[model samples]
Target: MTGSDPKADLHRYLQVARAAMLWKLDGLSEYDSRRPLTPTGTNLLGLVKHLASVELGYFGETFGRPSDEPLPWFEDDAEPDADLWATAAESREQIIDLYHRAWAHSDATVEALALDAPGRVPHWPAPRNEVTLHQILVHMIAETHRHAGHADIVRELIDGAAGLRKDNDNMAPGDQERWRNHRDRLERVAQEAGRSAAVLPS
Candidate 1:
């Protein structure tokens, strides 16, 4: 396939990562979407909330295009990790809509600046606070995809549903029995290794 323009290419990949992350929340009850699947309280909707705030800061305020939206979670007196989880009143619809709006605002910042356009990250430490549009684009891409990976695992834990996306599962074709057998084999190998390590000389 032919290549897209640089900005278009970056934006396309960012959208892919965003969609992949949001797709993990599809077809789940509100409780399931907000349920903390991991010990650290990582949940599908929480991830959406986190990314929305991340984009708003990196693309909006960092670049001098502050969003009209207020993020109480980032306020001075807010609790630690406030943006990392959704509150009871924060519905899945609200978080998702915020994320989509972040996309639009972030897109505007991208459109208004060149790749080499300079900006300062006020939250960052000295000597590394300044950045360009290209840097932020790459940074957000990595951040978005990292969360998408988390969402992939969380989604699987929720209902055993696993895939890169709806149309393309991106997993090897295997029956449930075959997959179970494979997992059992891996578990046995891991246990053996653990046992062997335990018996090693100090």
Candidate 2:
């Protein structure tokens, strides 16, 4: 246990989350990749674009190594939630390439700094703004994984595809018929539970 490198472990998890996010875009058409699947417009390529901005800010700007590339959506004059969705001009390949570049920059930051290396989050309030590489790593790992979960759902909604990764979906092995039956069972249980709740005394 003692011999295990904490940084390496954390980095590995981050990388996995990153890979999962990108994998969600696989086999998707341009329209599907940019499709606003949710009411608030959460899309696959948008997720990638958002993560790229997150990594650039947390790993680059927060540590005084701001990215050489410009992120227009982050500007003060840009429309709200601009980073959350891609425009028509922003090609899928362009956003994906940006994400790859962000990974390289973030990896470099992880490599160059020690776990205890101090940094400041400009947008964070009060003393919370002060943080270390370890804290940022943990924060980013959680952030990436959270968005990856969103991607999983969005991708499933787009098609029937669902899983943590390509090689291993991390889902129960079952045919479509079995899945439909399972869903029907859950719906029945939910309706029964709702009826039971409604019948209870206030």
The candidate that achieves the highest lDDT relative to the unseen native structure: 2
Candidate 1 residue lDDT tens string, 1-202: 9866998889889999999988999899899998998889999998999999999999988889999988999999999999988888989999999999999999999999999898889899977989999999999999999999999999988998888988899999998898899999999999999999999999
Q: Over all chains combined, what TM-score does candidate 1 have?
A: 0.95
Model 2, span 63-102: residue lDDT tens: 9999997999999999998998889999999999999999
| Model 1: CA > 4 A from native | 1-4
Find the number of clashing residue pairs for candidate 2.
0
Best by TM-score, which number?
2
Per-prediction TM-score, please? 0.95, 0.97
